[model samples]
Target: MTLPTSTLDLYWLPEAVEFSTAVTALRAAAAKGADGNADAGAAAGTARMLANQRLDFLQTRTLDRAVQGLPDAAWGAELTLAVLGTGTLEHLLPAIRVAGLRRGLRVRCWQAPYGQWRQQILDPAADLHRQRPDVILLAVDPAELLPDLPLSATAEEADTALAARAEEMVGLWRTARERTGAVILQQLMPLAEPPAFGHFERLVPAAPGALAARLDEALVRAAARERVLLLDLGRSLAEIGRRSVGDARLWHHAKQAISPAAAPWYGEQVGRVLASLRGLSRKVLVLDLDNTLWGGVIGDDGLGGIVLGQGSAAGEAFVAFQRHLRQLSRRGVILAVSSKNSPAVAEAVFREHPDMVLTRSDIAAFEANWEDKPAALRRIARDLELGIDSLVFFDDNPVERDLMRRSLPAVAVPEVPDAPELYGQTLADAGYFEPVAFTADDAGRTRQYQANAERRQGQAAATDMDSFLRDLDMVLAVEPVTPVTLARVTQLINKTNQFNLTTRRYTEPEVRDLRDSPDVLTFAARLKDRFGDNGIIAVVIGRRVEDGRTLDLDSWLMSCRVLGRGVEQALLSVVAASAARRGVERLVGHYRPTARNGMVRDFYPGLGFTALPASAEDQGWSLDLRTAVLPQPRHFTLALSV
Candidate 1:
């Protein structure tokens, strides 16, 4: 299949093009254009398949036919999305399942008993109580939860009604979390009632439209306070088109809150959010130099010849794209450059160009060399110490993009628009950096990576690893994982891969459970060197085994940026000391091999743990905390919380 570059408005963005024409060739091949496998890019294909198609039956059959099935083992993570709603959910399941593949998630959806959203949660015998679900989506209409007020009702009466609904939601959320330990998501009610007062609709506090808007606002605030994710179907469908928002006739006929026509888009939004929680979201944005970042070739055009900045339209477009990248960096998306151009020539543009919204400091890794774009991309990943999969490549050249896709199948390569102005929007629409919630650690990610670059340079200059570590004067501060530190600690547990031993992920509530359990031990590690502070780069969780004195290591994961710098050893020192204080005599650890966590296979052995024979590939290791002398911190001082 030919790739898009010369045409974008007519291509990828499902809403912008004719649905049937967009997938004519895609269907002939695999979902992702690879072996007609349903596990591939069916998530992306399903959206375009259902968009602009009105027949719900055709959408269901086509989506089901296209998304044959994705095996649970096909993805790195799997989750059961138990959808509890007051409306129809069967037509939406196929699209939701396929869309999850876009983020390497195998999503299995379960529809709650119809119109029993309350009984389902309040009763322990409900099927939802059979086992723990990873995620629970409560998609209910506002009218189902709140009372309708008369037009003559006071604003206080509306407020009273909204407050009671919010209270009930919190009760449901708490009950769900306590009962099932699932990440709860409350979908905001769609404002489907036609304008009762036109422009004056918003002023009427008791109007259906106004109450719907108020409920959304109230749900956002309550969800934020209660640690629940909000699925804004109103916003998602409104973008598709007003008609896709909801059809009153459909609601009356089949109780469909959202049009079945927009199921693909709905699933896409959901998949992105769920994938983000699993740490499948892209982190690094790798940009090409010549036509992608600027309008012309830097080698021939020089600094003066390149089309950039305010005077020309393309220049402003490039500036706007750069602005978008800079904004992403501020929100914790690491930025880097991967170009096949002279190092000096490319560096000169970023250094001297006045129109550049992205400065040198904004970039965590800068690769401007004579190597092929693929090689440059690999170097960028290595320099950042991130897996190649964490990157999203944006290049204006279709050949280069196609080459990267074939070479590194894991890396995300968005089809750049022919027009420069569409670059930022296209990238944004691609949804590479969907964050679950912005934490303090996310806010400092770019700066931390930039500091990591400085540390790499220092390591190269030193005589040996020891002196480099000693000269840096590193300090590791260890704290008990509390709600204050829960987000970052939970993030490190889910996000860190390479240096991890037994890659076990935990949701936020699970982390809190670890903190509350009397027999469990948890640690959040923060490292600071001479250069800058690496915020909460490591996490360790341990649970007391059946043998009271043995503490089984449930999880241990550290950021790759802090690897090989004695940070691992230092964190282990604190962990051992903490384990000793809890009357833990022996520590048992396990190494579960994953595609990305192979580097940590010998993590226990390196720390002097005796290998125990295993029946499977997962090897068990044990250390005598009573007799085995833990490594003394010669490279850094340690601080412990009281």
Candidate 2:
């Protein structure tokens, strides 16, 4: 029997080509390929463009088939997500799934009973509690949030009502956290169009617009909690424009708060939040120099000849792009240069050019040699101690961009618009570097890596390993898991690939559960040296097993920056002592091999553990406390806490 064709087969089409002749040919091919046998790239490109043009084009059947066709492993990570909203959100699911697929996430979405916001959260036995999600998105509409407010209400009444509603909202978030331990993504109330008071809306403090602003402020304060993230749907709506984003007729007929036209925009914002949670956020922005940073080639144009700064229109555009890059640098995104120009020539532009906003100091690494860009990018990744996948490369040359995309599929190589003026907005729209939480560590990460390089250079110059270790003046501070360090600990567990024994990943709630459990001991290791502080370099999670006689190491990982600085030994010593204090007679360790963690395959056995044969794929090792002792590092001044 011939089965009906599915739209899922068209999801892999290539984007539109520029040539009119090519477009005509592709359009003909697309028509002929409608039977699911067309060129996969062309079909995918057609489907994506159509989906963008009209969200209704993304059929539920297509999404279901696309999801089911994905291999179990294609769901790189599972994110159990629950959505609670005042209006119908069933129409938004397909868009959300499309966004999730783009980010390599499998989003299992659960929708709350319609308009049951308060009951679903307040009732302990609600289905939301039974299905513990990793993330909860609260999408209550503005009208529902301020249901008691009247247009003619007095200022005092409005103020009181807003305060009470804000309190209730925050309390619900706290209650949800206390019950389910899921991270909350709260959507700020959307701004209403055509203000109730017309031109006098700002004059009336009790007006709907004024009230919405007050509620937004309150939500911002509530979002300071570690597990809470604010999704700026109001801002997204404003950017997407109200004329197309909100449909009054749809709301009146179907209670759909957002128009189908705006579902894709909403889904992108939600997907970014999910990506940040899974640590898929891009860390580095590798930029090309010629025509990318300035109006012309640095090698040929010289420092004084390049079109940069404020005089010409083209020059101002480049400056605007540079200003944007500088803003990104301030917010913890590492920037680097990868160009095929002479190192001296490129250095002169950054060092001497008055129009340059990004100096040499702003870049984490600069590679301006005459080598293949793919090789240069790999070198930059190695020097920065980051995964190639964590990079986003931008080059003005199509050849260079295509080479990067083909050679390194993992790195995001965004197409640069022909005009330099569009560079800033193009990069902003890409949303490759979205962050979940901007910690002090993030702000100082580039400086930290630079300091690490200095430390490495010092280590190489030392006469002996012992001399190098002593010169580092390293200090290892070990502390039991606490609320203050819990976030970083969870981040390390998810992101640290190399030097990770067992390579286990955990969510924030799981980390908290382990920290609070009596049978488990978790500790975070912070290291400092003559150069600077490497915050939370290592973490050890152990569980008391065999009736408390054994301490089984569930996870042990260290930052690559402190790999050879004796921090690992210091961390293990503290763990062993803590176990001994708890009356543990033996220490058990396991190593799970992965493509990235082969460096740590022999980590347990090298630490004086005997191999224990097990049927499981993970290799097991054990150390008898009676016969084993913790090896103290001679260089580190250690402080241990139980």
Candidate 3:
């Protein structure tokens, strides 16, 4: 019942934990915890009721987090939590509704047809387009549900069967993607360690290694193809050592004794990941180099002594950890490093380490020095020039983490482990780092960060700004939304935060819906300087208003990557000319301010829009379409068709 640190609590992650424990408690309360000698008999009768009450409480808490986290403007949004197959859905649906009603979201659970029913819940194929949800949570395992026969198999063998089952699952997901634009995400099989076979295990296996891996591969591959998200509930369970449903003793201790005052440990983790995924943008991963990233301190151990490689246990763990980070970096996570070691030592390890997954060039920023981490983080923020809050900091020392948490609190700090093996799962479990989608720019992040460092160092040595700009040979591709570039455009609208003018987050469904509206216009801007191609980084959303004579800017947001280089003007010009050609009377612009959006408070005024004093709780400003002058840059050119 304690208030969570953030409204973005992950209730879904703990569904398995609470449910398993509730079942155990129901039996226990029914047997011993009830009435006298005759009362003891009565106690057995009340046990199930008591357990159900506990189950109801846990479910209520889950709903509370979701309801509390729903953004005010998103109230009345038709939210649907779809439990694809049977298991926890029966219990979860009721709790989700209670939570949804409290939050003002019109939420409903779509129960899929049982054997006798004629698909009472509309087929995803039929209802997806019309029954759009702000977010979709799928509890069923497609890989398990796909036509397969492995009832007699052990967990490991079943996992093999599941992997073999992936091709079909992938196809079905693709079909689902074609049908609906709603965000699709699958929950990990719950942790029921030393899991026994029955209803749940009969459908799927419990071997964490083979089964989980195959399922993960299947889910991640499907997510990549269908734009679905894979949230790791299994990893969350393992983190707390709640290995299996039989770990009732551990669950009881966790719930009653160990950390009674803390937020439900399970729910908190779930909520954190969910909130982050809901509002993901520019997934820049800034790693720490030293005892944190590797095993031993780089400065003390020396480059050769630093723990990494396949030889030693610690070295192997570090190597494995580095590989994982590199994988994330490759998946469009911008990689950077902050360390208190000498740059020479850091570079030597990056370049010379045989087992190293990342090199000196992979990092966006290599801030190594005597300066405290917050200061280094500031430099990394300035070098990348992104809001520090967007950066995810990983450090071995709790002191450094506390520094950032206390000083610049917005940055996400996943709890760090002393040992190396735990590093892989802890990082994976921290949802702050999860990316919903990847673009070409994401894949090239390491190289871009390396390029950024070189560019900045080059700029520092240059005599003047104009000389630097001219020497960079930056290429800008200002173009209208195309079929190929549509995904990145939607990603920008959904993710880009710091430089976003209005901070209006959009779902892919809404972005697709824009296609049918004649009044709405959206554009994706691609930038490639002498540094590197920054993929698609800017999105501008506006509508033709005033009887189709004027274009009014509804949302104009850009990733921090392309901010400093005067791309905004090119973006505005793109919109301006499109409006000019459309025979619109004028182009109107607006700027509304939020705490994080203050960086662009003067954005509209800078673009020649008059700032009106007309302010509401969510402030508003406007510029007349007629009075604004369209500024075109000789350096930037546009290629687009309205």
Error of 3 at 131 (Å): 60
Q: Provide backbone clash counts, one per model.
A: 1, 5, 16
lDDT of 2 by residue, 298-412 (tens): 7776665677754457876887788678757755789999999889888988887645778899988999899999999999999999999999999989999999999999999
Ranking by lDDT: 2, 1, 3
Q: What is the C-alpha lDDT of each candidate?
A: 0.72, 0.73, 0.58
Stretches off by above 4 angstroms in model 2 are 1-240, 445-642
Alpha carbon RMSD to native, model 1: 28.3
TM-score per candidate: 0.35, 0.35, 0.33
Tens-digit lDDT string for candidate 1 (1-642)? 122333212234243345455444445543444444553454444443454344344543564455444233334567888888765677777766655644446677887755556656766777887857899989887655544344444578677777766776787788888899999988875753233233344565655567778878888998899999988877765554544456679889999887777687677778877888898999999888798888889898777568775445787688778766765776678988888787777887778864566877887888877677788888888888899999999888899899999999999998888998888767766677876655546546445335543443323222234554675668888988854456567767887777888889899888888899988888888787664355677888889986669989989888765655667887788888888887889999999988898888889999999989885658999999889988788888788882
Backbone clashes, candidate 2 = 5
lDDT of 3 by residue, 1-642 (tens): 223333234433332345545544444533333322343333333322322332345655543332333233333455665445433356566566654554444565664322101121224333434555445565654333432222223445454555544544455454444555556666666532221111122233422333555666676776777666876766664545433222446567664433433436556556654554676443566678776667778777675456665335676677667766764654556788888878887788877754576777667788888888888887888888788878888888898899989987877787887898778667655555543433445444445334543343323222233443554467667666654455557767766667887778776668767755888877767776553345667888778887888677778888764544567977777777777777776666666666777778778778776655656534455545466676765455445555
Whose lDDT is higher: candidate 2's or candidate 3's? 2
Clash pairs (backbone) in predicted model 1: 30-36
lDDT of 3: 0.58
Compared with the true structure, model 1 gives a TM-score of 0.35
Candidate 1 residue 559 Cα shift, in angstroms, is 50
